[model samples]
Target: MMAPNNHFATLGLSIGADENQIKKAYRTLAKKWHPDKNHEAGAKEKFQEIAASYEYLSSKDRREMLERELRKPAAPAPPKAPQSTPQT
Candidate 1:
């Protein structure tokens, strides 16, 4: 099952992403994952998820309402440090 916050995950974006970033990511992914263009086995499902994520993020007025109701952004992840091989 998809997680509750799967939309942001699908777009490879932080949950607090501003609308422009959301739109930009949507356009980039949509072009890449469009089912007819992309023949990967899961491309249709991926495209659907991307379209829905974009729709959810595109609703500016609705987001304002949701933000007022929730009063908090989703947790922002800390940056990851580069991984290094351990001495063996």
Candidate 2:
């Protein structure tokens, strides 16, 4: 599942999406969800989320930081400590 705060997922785009793709997706979603256009229960909230996502991903530095974060490997789990047996 996509995280609630994931901007790429919010815009229905991939992490590797280019500027054009991001702009296109943002426009599409913004149009679809814009509170003025859609009267659905969550339209306003969704539109706001989309706008924030677009703003965040549109920045070159922020986008690069997110890409780097997504590309990073998961940290390895720490080794478990050996359990000692009770001495009689």
Whole-model Cα lDDT per candidate? Answer: 0.78, 0.88
- lDDT tens string, model 1, 3-88? 25446667888656789888899999999999989999999998999999789768887655544544455566788999999998
- Candidate 2 on 3-50: residue-level lDDT in tens? 235689889998878899999999999999999999999999999999
TM-score of each: 0.64, 0.79
Lowest summed lDDT across 10 adjacent residues in model 2 is found at 1-10
Candidate 1 TM-score versus the reference: 0.64
Candidate 2 backbone collisions, by pair: none
Q: Which portions of model 1 show Cα errors greater than 4 Å?
A: 1-3, 61-88
* Candidate 2 ranges beyond 4 A from true positions: 1-4, 76-88
